[model samples]
Target: MKNIKIVSLTACLAWMLSLMLFSSCSNDDANAENSGGGPVIESVMPSGYNVDGSMKPLTPVTLVDPKNYYVIHGKGLLTTQKVYFNDFDTYFRPTFVTDTDIIILVDENTPFADASNQLKVVTANGTAIFDLTVAPPVPTFSGFNLINAVEGDEVTIKGKYFLDPVVTLAKTATEPEVPITIVSSSLEQIVVKIPANANHRNLAVTNISGTAVSKEAIGTALYDDKLYGMQWGGPWSGKGVNFDFDGDSYQGEKSWQWVFGGWDGGNWGFDVDMTPYKAMRIAVKGTKNGQVNFSVNGGSNYVIPVTTTWVYIEIPLSALGNPASVTMLTFQESNNDGGNTVLFDDIGFVLK
Candidate 1:
């Protein structure tokens, strides 16, 4: 019985030793899995000041700037596959990635939408998602093409971040506030019409990001009596000829389309005295490099060179013998089967 008791004590001690060994091995395996298995994001920091690889305090910003580099802190991030800021996929270099951190740059063309602001990091093991904020830059108003625009004129506002912009003309103490009609808009440009009673003190543009007011007041006019603006003359005749008041243009905020098919022609006729103007300027954009003939008052034809991009073709009024009373201005394309398309805008006289 004494021998049996000593054997039982030895067995109990062995079992306890075995249990401790098994627990230690299991803890080591769990640590390895946590370090090597899935990705984990702890914090994000700007790449400029993250020189020592230490996790900085997370930014409290609600929107992350585009085109800026940021560092992410985590574990199991060495084999990162992709990274996304909001809905935009950004670039991440494996060389810049490590087991506990990642470097990435947010794309510039990311669209602003009402989607999740979660930053996602994908890896072979799993994905790590963190709630983030990303937004576009605020709208900026640099200047406009036409500083002095009339009521019926389409003014082109040139700036950045013009997505879904709202343009308004400031009201005077006497005059009521007027909202300018936006004819068309793009990411960098916006075309708006000057209201009839607009006392253009300040031009304001608001977008999803923010609002920007012009630095200087735009000169508003009721009518430009000196300039005879012929925008998209629809009275002309030509095959495949089309005109749109809200098309792509390099001048006057809009363009007219003229499709040429074997000697197509168009003209605008008016009974007026154009002796005051020294030259006639026509902004033209063509499909290819070519030449078009223009005639004034049915007199000598002046050849104007056109190219694939928008160009101003200024013809001296003396080329047409400086007619005192002008009756017609005509344009004719060369005969060809290529069916070239041309865009024209701002056909008027300038004082040189």
Candidate 2:
């Protein structure tokens, strides 16, 4: 009986000692897991952060061994974290990559709390924290087209990243695109004034940071000058008044012309010749009774009445017997009784 009691007491003491040792080891392991030096940050959120770039905060911060650890914050143990640049206020989900790297994407439009341009990193354990400098996104431009034009007319230009962009004309040695004052800016479109006398060719968009030129494109071009034909001397000059003949006032005395086969003073009823250039534009101003006939082939047969004042008449080269060799245009009239005087101006020919 005495032996049994001593053996039982000894067994009980051994069991208590083993339990104490196991408990100490377990505590040490737990402390090791929660050490101040948390998991290493492999990489940061947003590969390349730019000044105009955005961010999203409080997102998941993945860990290399995420299954083995948890994240912490003011509230409690968290599975993810939100981090961003100092001046950026965007939100991001921090994802753990490896012992040395993590991935994150900041919410757009959020200014970082700091301008130092630092990328923040939080460990999965929530105790380890660090920062890595991030770079802002580079500005770029694409697609440029000319607007509202024919050859020789000025037009506006359309494209991307036009706000505060360095505008320049491509392939042109002299003509360059000036800077466009952007009233608004976006990711897809930009409106601006291009150089005058622009031609279809390549164009360039640039900034202090970089330059972006377009693939060869066609643009509106400008034209040269226009040409006009010369004026010819005729009875119905293209003007409102004619000075080839003297005055013919029925009550007033005739100056230096004859009237109706009767000598008054001087040359009165006269005819002039026109060159062969297809057609003649005739302008005449005269009294209602001042009748005149257009004769072709040098003969007096068919006559047309001239009654309208300051009226424009077009006589075709074909009417005169299709005179392939027309030379002179004669006007004949017999004023038995006249009412008022007549006038003419600006008789000329235009090239077809």
User: Highest lDDT among the candidates is held by which one?
Assistant: 1
Per-residue accuracy of model 1 over 1-352 as CA lDDT, tens digit each: 0001112334334433543454355444543677667888767654332335443343534456676556676667767998988767888667666666665666767666565878889999899998877666788886565656657878778888776788988555666657899999887889898877543456788876678876445542111222243433433453565554455765445566777765677776666556546766677778887877788878888877778988866668888778886677778876355556777765655542
TM-score against native, each model? 0.46, 0.27
**Model 2 TM-score (2 dp):** 0.27
Taking every candidate in turn, the Cα RMSD to the unseen true structure, in Å, is: 17.6, 29.0
State in Å the error of residue 341, model 1.
7.8
What 10-residue stretch in candidate 2 is worst by lDDT?
Answer: 221-230
Model 2 error, position 139 (Å) = 6.8
The whole-model C-alpha lDDT of candidate 2 against the native structure comes to 0.37
**Tens-digit per-residue lDDT, 1-352, candidate 2:** 0001112334334433543453355445643554545443322322221234332232333221110111222211123354444545434333222222333334334332234544444435563343433322233443333322234333334443343455555535555554434443443455445445444444566643346665323321110011112123323322222333434311111211112221111112222233425554444445554655555556444344555445655556556565554345455443445333444333433222
Positional deviation of 346 in candidate 1, in angstroms? 4.3
What lDDT is reached at residue 198 by model 1? 44
Candidate 1 clashing pairs?
none
